[model samples]
Target chain A: MSVDTASAATTRAIVTDAAGSSSRARRGGQRHPATSFAGIALRTPYWVLTAGLALIFLYPLIWTAISSVSPLAGTNQVDGWGFGNYATLANYQAGI
Target chain B: MTATLHPPASSPAPPEARGARRPARRRRGRRTHGALAGWLYAAPTALFVLLLFVLPLLLVLQMSGSDWPLLSGNQGPNFPENYQVAVSNRFFMDSVIFTLKYTVLTTVILLALSLGLAMLVQESSRWKGLLRTSILIPSALGLASASLLFYVIYSPIAGPFADLMASWGFTFLGTPDGALWSTIFLIVWRYAGFYMLLMLVGLQGIPDDVYEAARIDGASRWQTFRDVTLPLLRPTLALTTVLCVTGSLLAFEQFYILTKGGPDNSTITIVQLIYSVAFQGPNDLGVAGALSVIVLLALVVINIAQIRAFGKKAED
Candidate 1:
């Protein structure tokens, strides 16, 4: 809605210039059609770099999730796996 | 009104116009009916607010003036005594200062960092969607849940980053400063995406032609950001600041989970001190209620001042 609502200047010229544009201000006009495979190839580094950075935001939770059931030393996983920790939690605080 | 609705006197009324006529009497009746329906729809929420919020607030106010013990419940009114106790409590000043520090630091860091991330995401590259989703993923989790996750993550004994910290000889929750910064890091990580989303909405609402114009004017990136974007983003920044400050001031769950206001109670927030007074040591619910009322008053004042500041800026 915002994108379409901003139908000000016909930004065809600016949008096409995105390949050559390296500045933040120039990125206002984006979403140009991929004219060649070279453009797609060029964008792969950005995807990789950002996706890798995204992992920094994500991996802690993912790690905690994995470790929650992986028999960590201090957990209440009495039976070595499967619902033991949850059962213990259910019984915690005088059965809630 | 009748003359206007009836159209020209010279012209015969169209059948459609005659059928669609909205007479004042009928309109009034319809307004009454609509009002009744609106109230009917709103009744549940009104009742909920009454039961959950208003009653609790009133009860807290009552407790603040009365000798409300944890086990024996409300003893007779001890007006001004509880307030005196609350103000004179050992942890009051420290917790207030700590809460203010946390609030200020987190507000500045979160707002600035989120604004930067918003600009980074503003570019409609293909990674825009992917990066937005990933960053926003943390915000989907509850604050308490995120704190719990961080509590374990900050554990040097079994944490994923245990060895990394061990190699550096730094433990996240060992020193008071470490605890504060670590908790702030967790907070920033968890909330950055949410604030970024807010900023992004603000950013997107700016017409592309503004940027085009600025570009035409040959303004530098920083100049454009300062002159154009920041000024326009004031409303969003105000909202974000209020939310950040309020949330930080009322911080409890994270400190409770991660440090328990520990390393000698260095991280105890105002809410935590209130909790401590209510549930532990001397266990005076009256003092806690008094503390709660004071906090509420402070919050109201702070929020009003913030809004006023923002309003003045916007006027300028």
Candidate 2:
């Protein structure tokens, strides 16, 4: 049991040393923090523009879902909310 | 030790032959089991299609024969009377002509635009990703939603283009011609990118070696494209054309939202007429069902014709 414990301790030490060296190597090879920050700043405008365009494309469906439930569906007024509009679908002569 | 523990390689009855025979029997059993498993896996999809598509189609056929009303229960079978009434309606015939016209125009424009865009974007370039994404963005919007947005855009009172158009002494949706053109424009803008994506997939399936061989043979760009690309793209083109025609024939939302069959019902689609017949007015569900059956028959005929045409080219 003592021999077994001793060997297990040696194995644990070897693994820790290997992990520490690899981490040090990675840190050494990585770009400077300031350069990485500048890279992100440079890419920001493209992301912002694309995101804005995507929102514009999606706004119509979002608007329709909201308008369907809004109480002022036929009227210009945009106040109050209920399932009143949906009830009209049931009132139609055909079974939708 | 060897004589006691092991068997001799040379025996009167060969072990190798016996071993091969055993494995062959096992393989035959495995093949039979594999076929059964395959059928078991396919059974669910077959059942689903039967229940949903075939059953509903049979029901619709039965409904078309009977005097089915919207609110009341089904009456006794009226046979061909409902079909005769549907066929005799002048408005229904006019809607059919209008739907055919729209289908032709939309399919032609969509094919041309999508093919053009696909060619432009086929090459690997810097802006290809952005161009593809930006173009496809409009297709993500539902047809109804896009029509509503265009409704606002075409409104004379509150439209952003109202002032510009007024300055030019023009109206976007004032007349039947104007409304039809506007709706067509909206549809083209919405679907061109989707069709372009389909065409792009077809284009990418082509190997680079084919183009290289064409170049080595000293064929001009236009000649090479005409001879090779068009022939190869036939299958994809057939698929897109069928989809475009079917969807255009069933068009309802754009006209309903943008024009509301306006300027004297000139923009009324066949589907809109069916909707009015079944849901509005006297609510004759029987006639509506007959009309739907007629439309389904037309679609099946068109699709079969398209498939045959494409198949002939493939054989060639």
> Which ten contiguous residues of candidate 1 chain B have the minimum total lDDT?
B1-10
Clashing pairs in 1: none
CAPRI-style class, candidate 2: incorrect
lDDT at residue A60 of model 2 (Cα atoms): 46
Tens-digit lDDT track of model 1 for A1-96: 677656543465555443245453345443444556776777678668778868978898789667657665567864465565676777889834
TM-score for chain B of each model, two decimals: 0.89, 0.87
- DockQ for the candidate 1 complex? 0.28
Off by over 4 Å in 2: A1-96, B1-36
iRMS (Å) per candidate = 5.4, 15.4
lDDT of 1 by residue, B1-316 (tens): 3555554776877987766765755898999999999999999999999999999999999999999999999989999999999999999999999999999999999999899888878777566877888889999999899998888789898788889999999899999999999999999999999999999999989876676677766789899999999998999999999999999999999999999998998999999999999998779999999999999999999999999999999999
Going through the candidates in order, their DockQ values are: 0.28, 0.05
- The sequence of per-residue lDDT tens digits that candidate 2 reaches over residues B1-316 is 3566446654445778888878899999999999999999999998999999999998788878999999996998999988998888778888999889989999999898889878765655445566666668789889988898888767676555669888887888788889888889889878978999999999988765566556556678798889889888898999999999999999999998888787788988899888888898659999888888998999999989989998998899
